[model samples]
Structure formats: C-alpha cells, structure tokens
Target: MQIKDRINAFINLGKFLSEIDTESNPILNKAEAENGWFTQDNINFALNSWAKALSEENIKQWLSNYNLETTAQRSKIVAIIMAGNVPLVGFHDFLSVLITGNKALVKLSSNDKTLLPYLANHLISIEPKFKNLIEFTEGRLQNFDAVIATGSNNTARYFDYYFGKYPNIIRKNRNSVAVLTGNETEDELTKLANDIFRYFGLGCRNVSKIYIPENYNFEAFFKAMFSWKEIINNNKYINNYDYNKAVYLMDSFPLLDNEFMLLKEDNGFSSPISVVFYEKYTSLESLKKNLKESELHIQCIVSKAGIPNEVPFGKAQNPELWDYADGVDTVDFLLKLP
Candidate 1:
C-alpha cells in the first residue's frame, strides 16, 4: 500500500473510534471482563485520545517531519511486543509500523489482547490492503527484520539477550514525575489529579512522584486530590492501598493519608497504586541537574519550573503524536532500517 493509503485508512479508523458510544460498546465490556483494570471510563479515554491524535491534520503534520516516500521500498516486517499495563498501550508502535508502509508482526499482551486486534479489523474493513500489513502471533515471532518491545527492566534484559542482533527499540521501565513550586493554581492541581488517578496510575506517563519545596504545606495538595476520592471505591485499588498502608504502618514509616491516597516522603520514582511519592527540593537548579542526570529513567516531567521539554501540569496523559516514548524516535528508527 502507498503512504497516502495508509494514512487515509488510519484517519477513517480514528473517526470510527470517535463515534464509539461507551455505554453501548460490547468490546469494552469484553475487555473489562478479561482485565478488571480496563474499566469503561479508562478504555474510552484511551480510544478518544487516539481518535484525536489520528486526525488527518495531526497525522499529516507529524509525518511532515520525516521522509516516508522511501519507506515503501524497504517493506520491512517489525516485531512488536506490547505491554498491557494500560489500554491500547502498544497501539502507537502498531500505527508506526503500518503507517511507514512496513508490515507489523504483533504479539499482544495478555492483559490487553482484545482491543488492538479489534481495531486492526476495523482498519482492514476500512482498507483491505491493511490485511496484508498486519499480523498477530500467539507463538514464537519469526521472519521479522527488526523488533520493538516494551516491558519491565527485567523483561527488557530477556529481550536484549534474544533480539540484540537485530535493529530494535527495546524499552525498559520508566516513570514520570512532577516538580511542584508550591504555588500551583487550584485548576492545575485538579488537572494533576487526572494525571495521577487516570488508568489508576498504571501508565508510564502518570505522575508517580513529585518534588515539593521544602516545608511545603500539604493542605492544598490534599484538597486538590479530593477530586479523585471516588477512585478509592475501586476494589483493586483499595486493596492495594490497604495492604501498602498496613505494611508502611508496620514498618513505622511516616505517611500522609487522606483516606483515599497515601503520600510518603520518598526519593523513588515508581510508587504503588493509590500512593504518590514525594521528595523535598531545596534548590531548583540543583533539582534540574539531578533530573537531567536521571533523564533515561524518566518518561516525562510535569512542571512549571522551566525545565526543558516539561509537560504542563495535568497534560501528561494527552501526549501528542510526536511524543515518542523513551526519547527514542520510532519513525526515524523504522525509516533508517536497512
């Protein structure tokens, strides 16, 4: 298929996603049945986000940055090992491989097995040529020119051991964080709540940690987090919260609790569900340097502190089409494949 044909097919798929009625969507029910974490609201959020991103204008503009006309001649097959932490997490890789006029051999995450294939079928119905461009495997992956895999740091080691000889983009675990100046507006804090509670904090883009000015008061932060108090009603989240809280209490660790989420002073980036880690910062300059040193471990930064490439508070989940994960350009990687 030509580049134009591929783009047009995705544009139509976006329109289909935009028109889905969550209240009446059967696929969503089946997804939730397979994975309890795939709640209706979160699944629709992922669908709608992709819908907005796949617009003709957005896709065209994003593609303008690259030369894709030459990509068709290579016709490579890319192996994609998707992560199932959040709904449709691997859709970006799937879209990249196909839109660049390359074939995709996909291995669906067991946690997110149903959604992408269903969408792939929709794409095929829109453009039958896509039937030749996409394949899903339940067994060993073979006959692939390159690989794109996402997993935890441990699994990433396994991917490296196996796929190291090929051209690849093997991603390891990374977390997002926020730098708070302690002067954020109520609206900004409310928006930050979405970044925190959305998908129950499973996404890499979620703010798992925050840097607060020393002596920062917790009153406003707690009040702002109240907006997501309803998240406590989720059984899995509450169970985690209860268990983690008990463990912390047994260890006599200091904790700030608001009955819904726990806040602990920690230097770590990855926080458990229903908990957000926080650290006190004395100097912005020093903190920026520290963050710069740890860039590889961070997916994105949410801040108004003027750090380079910082994502504004509450906008972490709404990544643009160009926000490549792990600071690696997937399109450029594909286009350069020999």
Candidate 2:
C-alpha cells in the first residue's frame, strides 16, 4: 500500500478507538483511571494524527535515502520493549517496525499488557497484513534483528551496557521543562496546562519543572489551571498527591495548596506528584546556554521566546510522525542499517 493509504488506515483505526468501550468493563475503567487506558478519545487524537501525517507519500518524500539494495528485505523483525507509564508508549516503535515491513516482536510492559494486544487486534481487523507482523510474548523475544527500548535512567544504564551490543535504540531517563518570561498572559498558561495533563504528566515529555523570573506570582497560573482541578479529584492521581504532600509536610516543608496537590519550588532536575517546581531566570541568553550545555539531558523545552525557533511551548505533544522520542529518528536509523 502507498504511504497515504497507510495514513488513512491509521486515521480509520483512530475512529475505531474512539467508539469501542466496554460499558460493563470494570477492568477497562480501572485501567483508564490509573494505567492510562488507550481510550477512544486518546486513541482518536493520537492515532488519527499519526496516520494522516505518516502517509507513504510523506514517508517516501522524507526517506530520500531509501534504496532497495538490501538482502531479505521486507521481512525482518524488530523487538520492542514498551514503557508502561502511559498508554501506547510503545506504539510508535511498533509503527516504525511495521511500516518498514518488519515483524514486531513485542515485549509488553506489565503495566500496559492488554492495551497493545487489543490495539494490535484492532489493526488486524483493519489490515490482516498486521496479523503476520504483531504478536505478544512474555519472555520469548529472540529472532529479531533490531530492538527499541526505553526505561528509567538507571535501567537505561543497564540497557546500554547490554543492548548496545546489538542493533538497538536504547533511551535513558530524560525529562522536559518549561521556560517562563514573566510576561505570559493567562491564555498561554492555559495552553501550558497541556504540557502537564496530556498523560497525567507521566511521560518524559511531560513538563516536570519550569523556569520563571524571581518572585514570580503563581496565582495567575493556578487560576488558569483551575479547570484541571479534576486531576487531583481523580482517586488514582490524588493518592499520589496526598502521599507526596504528607511526606513533604511531615518533613516540615511548607506547601502552597488549593484543593489538589502542593506546589513546591526546589533545585532539582524534575518534580514529583502533581507539583511543578520553578526556577528564576534573569536573561534569555543564560537559559539558552544552560539548555545547550544540558541538551542531551533535557528532552523538550516549552518556551514562548528567548529559545531556538524550532522549540515551542505546548507544541511538544503534537509532534509530527518523524519526530521520535529523545529526537532520534528510528526510521532513518533503521533504514541506514547495513
């Protein structure tokens, strides 16, 4: 099939995802609340967009180095080690392998075992060709020529030490941050909320901390995000807030609270729970220099100005098809493999 047709297939799958829900599914509801289910809404938004942009025409246009000079083409396998932190985190890896005509040997995350298989099943209904390419495994993951793995900073150390010996893309722990100029209006703050609540602030792409000018008032930000009070109202999410808040309060740490979680400012790389820590910046040039120094460590930067033209706040979540996590293009890399 053409790349455009493949994109349409993805869009069609998104529509299917938006409608299929088990009304009597206790398992489904529980997963949605805590584990970030592949909900119809989430699925539609994610899959539909991915599909439309990843059409063959677009893929071929971008994949200019595509040469049909490889041996045993269109039948290789790629093993995928998925992250369980959010719904369908591994789907991108799966898509890269499948679109390149390689079978996917998937090692599903225990935290998200059902969603991938269900999604694969849905894709099978959409195109039976995927049936030959997708399958679930507990431990039997041999026979793949390449692998894609994502894990914590600690686990990434292990993954690199091991998977480095093979044809693999091993991702370490990377966190995103926001840059505030102390001049943002309320609308910008509302849009900034997307950087936080997209996946309950689960993925590394989520904004863990932000940079604001000294003594910057946060009431406006809090007020802007008032509609998201439901994030704390969620039992699963609230439990995290309460547990973390209690630990902090017990340690004699002051908390600025409304109804959900505490807002704590600290000198760290990232924040925990529902709170987002901030730092004060005096100049844009300093922020840019710090970002350049920490480029490999910083995953995404949410900023209005005083940064590179390529990076934009709230635009991190709507990444195009070619934009891989940690900014590595898996398709480009795999296509270059000898």
Candidate 3:
C-alpha cells in the first residue's frame, strides 16, 4: 500500500480503538481473558495515547522530520519480536516498518497475543492492501531481512547471538526516572503520580525511581501521591507490595510506607511494582554526572530540573511519535535499510 493509505489506515484504527469500551466491548473482553494484565483501564490508556499520536497532523509532522524518498527504493521484510510489558508496547516498531513501505513479519508476545492481531485485522479491513504487508507468526520466524527485537537484558544477549547476522536493532531492559527538587507543586506531584502508577508501573516509561534533594520533606510528596491510593485494590499490585515489604522487613532494610506503596532508599533504577526507589541528591552537578555515566540504563527522565531532554512530569507515558525507544531513530534506521 502507498504511504498515505498506510497512514490513513492507522488513523482509522486509532479511531476504532478510541471507541472501545472495555466494560461492553467484546474484543477487549476477549483480550482481557487472554491476559489478565490487559485490564480495561490500562488497555484504554494505551489506545487513547496511540490515537492521539497517530493523528494525520502528528504523522505528517513526524514524517517531515525524516527523508522518505530513500524508503521507496524497495520493500524488505522487517521482522519484529514484540514485548508484552504493556498493551501495544511493540506497535511503534510495527508502524515504523510499514510506514517505511516494508513488510512486517511479527512475532506477537504470548503475554500480548490477542490485541495486536485484532488491530491488524481492523487495519486490513480498512485497507485491503495491508493484508499483503502484515503477517503474524506462531512458530519460527523466516524469510525476513532485518530484525527489531525488544526484550530483557538476558534475552537481548540471546537475540544478539541469534539475529546478530542480520541488520538489527536490539533493545534491552531500561527504566525511566524522576528528579525532584522538592519545590514541585501539589498539581505537578499529582501528575507525577500518573507517571509512577500508570499501567501498574510495568512500562519502560513508568517512573520506577526518583531523586529527591537532601532534607526534602516526604509529607507533601506522599500527600500528592495519595490520589493513587486506590491502586492497592489491584490484587496483583497488592501482592507485589506485600511481598516486597515483607522482604524488606526481613532484611532490616529501612523503608517508608504509606500503606499502599513503599518508598525505599536505593541506588537502583529498576524498582518493583508498588515500590519506588529513591536517592537523596546533595548537588545537581553530581546528580547530572552520575545520570550521564549511567545513561544506558535509563529510558527517559521526568523533572522540572531543566535537565537537557528531560521529559516533563506526567508526560512520560504520552510520548510523541518521534520519541523512539533507546533514543535510536527507528524511522531513520528503516529508511536506510539495505
């Protein structure tokens, strides 16, 4: 299909997704059954974000940032190994491959088996031409030229060994963080709660940890986060909270708890669900240096600290089309594929 047709198809797909009501939508109900993690609210959040991002204006603006003439030379089979951490986590890669006029050979993550296929079917229906461009695999992936794989750090090693021969973009585990200066208003902190609790903190974009200034009071921070107290009602999240809290108590690790979430002093970036790691920073210069040194493990930073390229509070999960994961330009990579 032509690029315009492909873009329009996705735009329509987004509209369709925006209309899905999990309480009454049959397709979403089926998806929820396939994976309990794909709850109505989480799935809707993901869909609505995509719908906003895939607008005709946004798509045109994103494409304007890249050269498209090179992508017209030939169509290659781009293999995509998707991740199931959040709903439609791998949709960006799939969209990138097709928007560049290439075929997609996708291996759906078993954790996210049903949703993409349902969306793919909708895409094909919108434009029959897409029927020839998209394919989902149940077994081994074959007849593909280049590959884009997203997995944990361990699986990344395996991917490097297996798909190493092909031109590839292999993504490993990464987490997002927030840097708080203790001057944030209640509104900003409340928004920050969305960054921390969205999707049950399973997405790479979720703020798994934060850096607070030395002597910062926790009262305002905890009070702002109280808006998300209902999260404790989620069985899966409560289980994780209880388990991690018990582990911390057993090990005599000092922790700050507000009954629903645990705040622990840690130097780590990746925190468990229902837990957010924190560190006290005495100086911005030192924090900047440390962040620069460990940049590879971070996906995005949320703060009003004026750090270069830092995503604003509460906006981490609502990334634009050009916010490619790992800072690797997917469209640029696809356009240059030989």
Question: Which pairs of residues collide in model 2?
Answer: 3-55, 3-56, 4-56
Best-fitting candidate, measured by TM-score? Answer: 1
In model 3, the clashing pairs are: none
- Write one digit per residue (lDDT tens) for candidate 2, span 10-74: 55665665555555445455556555434534544454555555555655664555542341255
How far is each candidate from the true structure, as Cα RMSD in Å?
Answer: 0.7, 3.3, 1.1
Model 3 C-alpha RMSD vs. true structure (Å) is 1.1
Worst 10 residues of 2 by lDDT: 65-74
TM-score, per-candidate, Cα-based: 0.99, 0.86, 0.98
Question: In terms of lDDT, which candidate is strongest?
Answer: 1
Give candidate 1's root-mean-square deviation (CA, Å).
0.7
* Residue-level lDDT tens digits of model 1 in 1-338: 78898999999999999998888778888999999899998999999999999999999998998988877788999999999999999999999999999999999999999999999999999999889889999999999999999999999999999999999999998999999998899999988898889999999999999999989988988899999999888899999999999999999999999998999998889999988999998999999999999998899999998988999988899999999999899999999998
* Tens digits of per-residue lDDT for model 3, 108-183: 8999988888888988998898888899998998889999999999999999999999999999999999999989
**Model 2: number of backbone collisions:** 3
Score residue 285 of candidate 1 by CA lDDT: 96
